[model samples]
Target: MADYLDFVGDPGRDDVEGWLYPTDAHLMSVVNDLQVDRGFRGDVLEIGAYKGKSAILLGFFPEAGESLTVCDIFDSGAPVSDGNARENTAFYPGLLQTDFEKNYLRFHDRLPRVHVGPSEELGEIVAPGSCRLVHIDGGHTYEVARADMETARRALGPAGIVVVDDWSSAHIPGVAMALWERYLTGELIPLAFTKGKFYATWDPAGLTAGEVADAVATRPGIEASGTVRLGRYAAAGVTMTPGDWQRYNAGLRAVYSKLYADGGASAPQRVGF
Candidate 1:
């Protein structure tokens, strides 16, 4: 197995080459435990992959028979809503499939099945009920978010998870609205929340969010009880501020990089909890 720690300590850093948020570590733990530890079997899906940051991590958990499907606009010039266009222009001006493939190849030998167009084309591409984990981060508008959630639900298998990005961000209230509306209507059961993602599932038996948070709390410097109850479900929060976590992660990345550069073995090394 590839050393996950070597590739994922800080994906936004120069060496890692992507735009992953720091809370991704917690998300990784959730995905790892569900697919790797619990032996869930199915393909992986992600609606938005800017440069394969989170996609790289998701790629690591797919079992032998599973595939990872990544859907992104990727210089397709597809027409989007005005708001989405503005946001994409401002944030992902240089988004390209080649860059995504290059970065993904650093950690994975084969590139995921790439769908280059609007996420609306997902139904025609990915089979229904075939995904173990589906990540929705494509568009922040209410229409797009809701449509993506619907697609994710249709694509998820039993015990499958749907992780939505920017769910609670003040700048992206549409995502929160879409997710809460689904949760209220019983289409989704809230599992957990990271700094930038909301994890949900259709099955009540998949209540592993609290366990994920508890495991993260056990990390060296993180405070306990990062898990919070949300009505019938659970949500996890980061104890440290985003800035603090970035700084700490940068330090850890530097240490690991140096250790690996010295021809040292890549064993799992625990840092702050």
Candidate 2:
């Protein structure tokens, strides 16, 4: 665990709430990539905003006019009738099992929308192509993740980035497996899975038939909510605002660069949420 944490960068950061909160490292990477690589400057859509940690990170990017939309099934929103649902409830009990209300209040006026409901439900509320980045941190089940991914895909802009949390993590092996199998065929590919979170991108021009066939061959009948093409302006690097760069040490960069090094379009298997 220590090695994993070290390899992924520190799990402890004052800016980030805690383990319960999504790490800023992933969002930081996304912001830097979008600004420098894709020239994207738009709203960020976060599917799950437990304690608003990850949303905070996205909120801090240099781009002006870029807002954030938060979606979550807070405080018993998900009915716990079956075994899996009960397990989910147990895992994230009673409003994120944290100070979600306080966190919600913390970002009350900061972001654009504080959507509360299931991913599918909230998906309808978001306008198509309104999101430049979709962060999926909702449910871990295959059905739920797939639905969330589809919604994010539809909501994202042409050169948008879709980030899926816990994609390559042991905490939810089923989600990771489903993501990998689907990725093999889709235009979306795994970018980075730092700190138990996985990032994927959509290139409107990148989708291919061969990849889809391969994905289908590996996992048959697994349908995606939607698919998009991979676009140009491909950019991946580590560039932070001067202040942020100084605050975060070189050790963090070394670790992140290594983690994101061989993490191109290939499916990852060693990630544990």
Best by lDDT: 1
Each prediction's TM-score versus the true structure: 0.81, 0.62
Worst 10 residues of 1 by lDDT: 5-14
Go through the candidates in order and give each one's C-alpha lDDT.
Answer: 0.74, 0.54
Model 2 spans > 4 angstroms off? 1-17, 20-33, 36-38, 62-64, 76-84, 96-98, 104-112, 204-273
Residue-by-residue lDDT tens digits, candidate 1, 1-273: 235543444433335444454455445554556556666778899999888777888887787898999999988898888988998988778778898899889878999899999999999989998988898889988989999999999999878898888887798799999989998985577766656677778966654666666666665433333567777766766554555566767777776777688688663323432
Q: Which clashing pairs does model 1 show?
A: 219-273, 220-272, 220-273, 221-272, 221-273, 222-273
Give lDDT tens digits, candidate 2, residues 144-189: 7777878887897766667677765676776776676667675665
Off by over 4 Å in 1: 10-18, 214-224, 238-273
Q: What is the Å distance of residue 252 in model 2 from its true position?
A: 15
lDDT of 2 at 240: 30
